[model samples]
Target: MQIVNKAVVFESGHEEYAVPIQSVISIEKVNFINPIPHMPLYMRGVTKAREDLIPVIDFESVLYNRSLAGEEARLLVVQTESLQIGLLVKDAKEIIDIPQEALKQMGIAAYEKTKYFIGVAAFSDRLITIIDPDILVSSLEGIKDIQEYMKQNKLFPA
Candidate 1:
């Protein structure tokens, strides 16, 4: 008898997508208790977790140029070098294990106009675009202002 196989599964944009579980960090409940004024549209708001106020970055809006349409969202905590940020996902799904061969490089046309989505991975009938949080944070004009405020407040890195 022959048997079929399943692959790495994850939640993206409220859909069931799959990727290597190795790329994923444990999902957490988004704390919507804090709010900031004049934040970019991609910034849903700020939340406090473990005594740190982390900015919740809206994933879909940043990547697809869309807005929050009332879809439930979650916070994906990701670490990039020395900086750690929370990714605001509309819906985070389960983790699945798939073959690395399924991954492919995204064409330049997809990012020639914008550097938002870095790459895409195909799983089943869905296409999942890998979001680079650093790019979003670095490109944000408010970052400098925030940094300045932090420096004035003595919160700047010493």
Candidate 2:
């Protein structure tokens, strides 16, 4: 028996990253994102996906401290503990299975620097940094309020 984790691979700048496939609910094109004022710079806006309005975070903005990049943009609609948030990325067309043994856990320094990183794993010839979606959502400031706003507005079914 082998322990393998299925993950959705995405690109941000020159680096590759992955999140548990189980966390992702859908992959969508960049239809339209309605910007919300006074939110975090990285929090691009809210977008409708599969009848649910999810908070979209610009991955490039978060990582590179710049606006969203890449020619083809996509939204990785991932379900965290309490919210179905959208992560806008350069690309998200690959789903791969990563073996448990392949994961290289980050040391204390790495963990201290990034709380959302689960580990690093080599897939194909590139390095993919595994990200924990729960921590990714929780680590952001003012995200809770966005979740609450969605719930209170009945944006999606309760």
Candidate 3:
């Protein structure tokens, strides 16, 4: 028996991505998003869940340059060291324990947005890209502004 790193897998842009299960707070039904003006395209605004307000990241927009199907989306609430946010993913499937041997270092240089990607894990049927939520959130161009708006508007804790 062995202890493995487990992650929560979700679908975005017809591909699978993952974050550490330990970083996951909750998976919630998509709620109404109160949009803000002048925010980045990847930001879908703020939503209330788990008795708290959190900014919604449009995963499709952020990763795929596509619009999210809000009606069929799921809010994957995740927390980093200090900040909390929701990832609006196309679908959330399951949690899997990944063996240390299964993880591979990221080396792609063309994408230019691999800052958040920790590595890739290949299973029999699918390959999943694992990401660090902290890096992913911090890598966004207007994430600070988004966070500031949420804080100043009484939407999220400062």
Candidate 4:
């Protein structure tokens, strides 16, 4: 089977995960000074992008329960059904293509806990966790209507 060699891979501390490149819009450097109250700790913060204030999640903290130092971090812009979110990671890696058969789904149980990893896919001898942006977005609370939710919270300044 022909494999697609396009995915946005990034490093969070020592671990690496890949999201379908097609789902990404842009990668940016983010410094968040405002955050939503009563949200999960893994939810890093929020920042303004264009006319929208995007919610950002700490990829490392959510996955591994460790916060990465933000000195050399980057925000990966992933498109969700409702809004564009920035996933904060330590660094971004190269995009690569691997065979489709090499990917192994971790099943529903794994995804139920993490809610980030859609499946586990192999790349050569190493395994790269494949992330489904849709799952990530859907798992976030109150993201049903992204625009209205942000507006209700006044995530943007007047």
For lDDT, the strongest prediction is 3
lDDT of 2 by residue, 25-70 (tens): 9889989899887888998888999987888999888778888855
Off by over 4 Å in 2: 1-4, 108-113
Q: Rank the candidates by TM-score, best first.
A: 3, 2, 4, 1
Best by TM-score: 3
Alpha-carbon runs more than 4 Å astray in model 1 = 1-25, 64-66, 69-71, 109-116, 147-158
Q: What is the Å distance of residue 97 in model 3 from its true position?
A: 0.8
- Per-residue alpha-carbon lDDT of model 1 for 1-158, expressed as tens digits? 01113323335456543323333354677656354567667766556555655556666676567764444666776544334456666666655433455555667625544454455566677666554445556766566554454456454242
Error of 2 at 50 (Å): 0.6
Return the TM-score for each candidate structure: 0.67, 0.89, 0.92, 0.78
Pairs clashing within candidate 2: none
Task: Evaluate candidate 1 by giving its C-alpha RMSD to the native, one decimal.
Answer: 6.2
lDDT against the true structure, per candidate, is: 0.53, 0.82, 0.84, 0.72
Candidate 3: tens digits of C-alpha lDDT, residues 1-158: 12239999999887899989989999988969888889989898888889898888988898888779856699999998657999999778899989888888767722668678778888888899898888889889998898778778777667
Model 1 — which ten-residue stretch has the worst lDDT? Answer: 1-10
